[model samples]
Target: MSVETDSHGRLYLSSELRQKYGEKFHIVEYEDRLELVPIDEDPLQAVREAAGDAFEGESIEELRERAREQAKEDAEAGFERGKRTAEGGNE
Candidate 1:
């Protein structure tokens, strides 16, 4: 179906289209065209779907602890790498 924008350059979707797709959309613009992508209304559910089983049996507290430990390890590794770089080491 063909759609047109108003004088203000705003396009309106028909109720049929809205019901078929969604109320919320992300407009992607290419050099020569525009496309609309439907967005999930429930953002947390979307994240859960995308994450899949990555967090499987882990509790929130366990995840937080793991994140903190990983951050500390990353900081220490970065510091050691910087030290070695400053000392002209290949490590």
Candidate 2:
């Protein structure tokens, strides 16, 4: 569908579109075009729905510790890879 912005640069969505999506949108710019991404009205609720069972059996502190450990491991692995690259080693 084609949409045009007004003099004030406000692109109005149709009532049907607004009802399907939400009132807010994020405009993403790419090399050839722009895309409108709908924003969730309740972002936290959206995250909860998206996560589903991923975080089901973990407490907040437990999750935080797990994330920290994973991040540390990732950083160490990246450092090892960089070190190998600097030493002219191919992986």
Candidate 3:
């Protein structure tokens, strides 16, 4: 239940405490205190770790570009799948 500040003076989760909890927790800020809620390891870390620095502190323009790229990829994938299905599911 201690407070910690990062290099930029922003609050940060304690790595030691997180490790002690076996990497299964959710941090919630309630009123003036921080609360830790236990969550299963997967949902707790999967999305975040998978996401990585993809959008970390990115600006609106950068995020829009990423979104555009993702949408283009998705559309291309869908078109490929449709083409395959139309072609009797050929590889």
Error of 3 at 71 (Å): 0.3
Collision count for each candidate, in order? 0, 0, 0
For residues 1-91, could you state the per-residue lDDT of candidate 3 as single tens digits? Answer: 5677878976555688667666555789988977778675676255557789765777768777988999999999999999999999974
- Colliding pairs, model 3: none
* lDDT digits (tens) for residues 3-83 of candidate 2: 898999989889999999989989999999999899999985687689997878777799889989999999999999999
Model 2 stretches astray by more than 4 angstroms: 57-65
Ordered by TM-score, highest first, the candidates read 2, 1, 3
Better of 1 and 2 by TM-score: 2
In lDDT terms, how accurate is model 3? 0.75
**Deviation from native of the Cα of residue 51 in model 1, angstroms:** 4.3
**Candidate 1 lDDT, tens digit per residue, 10-39?**
889999998898899999999999999999
lDDT of 2 at 47: 72
CA lDDT of every candidate? 0.90, 0.90, 0.75
Q: On a 0 to 100 scale, what is the lDDT of residue 85 in model 3?
A: 90
Give candidate 2's whole-model lDDT.
Answer: 0.90
Q: In candidate 1, which residue pairs clash?
A: none
The residue-level lDDT of candidate 3 at 43 comes to 67
